[model samples]
Target: MVPDDLLLETRDLTKDFGGFLAVKHVDLRVRRGAIHALIGPNGAGKTTVFNLLTRFLSPTSGSIWFEGRDITRARPAQVARQGVVRSFQISAVFPSLTALENIRVALQRARGGTFRFWRSDRVLEGLDGRALSLLADVGLEDQRDVAAVELPYGQKRALELATTLALEPSLLLLDEPTQGMGHEDVGRVAELIRRAAAGRTVLMVEHNLPVVAGLCDTITVLQRGSILAEGSYAEVSRDPRVLEAYIGAQA
Candidate 1:
């Protein structure tokens, strides 16, 4: 039985790619309204776990439960509709669309799982207020009129975050939300994530340990596709196995 406070759980999750075991016997638990992080060196299968959770890739064995429902075999769209929305490791945005428009597109999809491109502008305008609010939530309000391509790299990522939030996900899955970001941009985006995490659960795969240390309430370290350590940042950082395998001398 899943605890009332747990929002997502995976039991003995494994993924086999031909003869390669990308992920093996992984158990992940994400508590409701907490910021959790998956961190590891390359080839640790952090992304693979995210794919399995969202059904982008099927696990060879094991089951995934979200909100107490088994979703091991749920379709990608079905998982998304269940309020599990993921942001990719790369910045994904409509280049030509303004920040507000990008968010509006997500809002439209969230409404009925279809983009009503044929709908009259006036009809779609109803979503503008909500879209603008989402943009503001991610600190993109000032870029509302700027095309995604015109925004700086950090703002582009922020816009992507805004769009993801527009879906009203109960569990937000962020894949390297700060990848390729400058120092300043990292801090900004981190702050945005902290603010956006209010009242919702966040599960992120992040490489920047500082960002993980600052933002995540619980940290799960992976090594060779299996969990190495799971605890608060301070606890995991001090774990001898975690330090030797993943953190090296950094801890």
Candidate 2:
């Protein structure tokens, strides 16, 4: 079971691009082995928060604690090595490489062996099994040999998750898994995400509220740059402010 105490925490997190605040003094607590969703309109600083957690952007005046480690100013690679890794909202994969090879490359990178050309041309130790298992886990076992670019949009996203899984991160940060997908494709991908959430800690920034309601046990809604509401789907969705700020858009 996932720990109830927070696996990732931020104390008054803030970010500034010059004088403008992209993310305000926000605080977040994500528990271990649970699925948590972050939702907001465009330009609400969801991506900015991701950058801070991954060490892609340093927080302006906040401290980030992850799995009990203070990584407020850690390097990107260091963050990944410490078991917090992120996947993009858009596809981030090698277009020309096969799904199997994509995961193989990530496995090598996770172990810091991708650059060791001096070793024989053989793949990293045990990577074949790991890559195969990852591909199978994402339900792409049959497509393992297909070039990543040859697959449809949804498959590309699955490939991205497979690559991220090869890194063996304890915490997974997903930008948006359902973006640019058709109804059937969205359902398929949602199930894929469900599989991923079983034993992994997930923090996702998603725009689709219905999807969030169906999948997430807890939801955080942001407006402008800070949280507007947080709770279960029914609790937050029924709030008058949430309805005014969000539901009015679709209705």
TM-scores for every candidate against the unseen true structure: 0.94, 0.93
TM-score of 2: 0.93
Tens-digit per-residue lDDT, 1-251, candidate 2: 34448899888999988998998888888988778998877888999999999999999898999988889988998899888989997889999988888998888776666667688746454678889989988889999889999998988998999898888788999999889989888888788888888788899988877778888988888877788898888899899988987677547
Instruction: Judge candidate 1 against the unseen true structure and give its global Cα lDDT, from 0 to 1.
Output: 0.91
Badly placed stretches (over 4 Å) of model 2 are 1-4, 249-251
Q: Write the per-residue lDDT of candidate 1 for residues 1-251, one digit (tens) a residue.
A: 34888999999999999989999999999999999999998999999999999999999999999999999999999999889999999899999989888998888876663656676677768899999888777777888899899998888898998898888899999999999999999999999889889999999999999999999999999999999999999999899999898878344
RMSD of 2: 2.2
Model 1, position 125: C-alpha lDDT score: 82
Best by lDDT: 1
